[model samples]
Target: MLTGQTLTTPQVVDVANEHEVGAFIGHHTLAEFHGVEPALLDDGPQLRDMLTGALAQSGATVCDIILKQFEPQGVTVLALLSESHASIHTYPERGSLFMDVFTCGTVAKPWLAVDLLAQAMGAADVRTNTVLRGDTHPCCQ
Candidate 1:
């Protein structure tokens, strides 16, 4: 099983519900979209373009793009953005893609990448794992 980690401390939270203080009142949603088409998976330019567009469309600018490819065109692309990062690993043989999009202070945008992937893969369907990014509850008033 693949698990994830999220940091949360009391200093990070600030009464989420009411304006009762509103410290940790912000939310950041992280999502993983996987299971993409296999045939269209290629590394380098394709991956770079996708990663770049995904971040840019989400109101984040990419400062760096790292893409690696394996035999049979299995590509892993990591995009480092000003706000956060978005990554995609495509398995061409299985026609699957493992994607992670995360942001710190803003809500993550999923449809941009999803649309691009669907076009790139001609995917029949896509799946998503949306994590609410659990953090510490602010007890301080």
Candidate 2:
């Protein structure tokens, strides 16, 4: 043992060891955007198009999506994404919506998707909740 150094055992230390540190990516950002909307979500085709556009902006491709109108002022939408999935429930009379986006990959941009939904529904003064996902390598130790 010296002043600036220490003695070591005969074992070898591999400095070249490398590993994958994937971003805290899955479900990285989940936001709840709600506000007063001037439109209703009852048109299946229209809803599909809006969601499709949102996902498209974030470099994602949609395989399939489904939208259902519960009533005059209520609706439920289930959206499928190549990375994962997202959904929204609208209450027209209340002019509010409950939205969720869960996905994994570099293409996961929840903000873009939420913004598109807000624009499509004509929502103003929107609110949001962001949940960043995390993934760790158990073997990192």
Off by over 4 Å in 1: 1-37, 107-112, 134-141
Task: Choose the strongest candidate by TM-score.
Answer: 2
Cand. 2 TM to true fold:
0.68
Off by over 4 Å in 2: 1-24, 32-35, 136-141
What is residue 100's positional error in candidate 2, in angstroms? 0.9
Q: Give the whole-model CA lDDT for all candidates, comma-separated.
A: 0.55, 0.58
Q: Per-residue alpha-carbon lDDT of model 2 for 72-137, expressed as tens digits? A: 557677778867787777666666667777666544566567766666666655665555454333
Residue range with the least summed lDDT across 10 consecutive positions in model 1: 1-10
lDDT of 1 at 101: 68
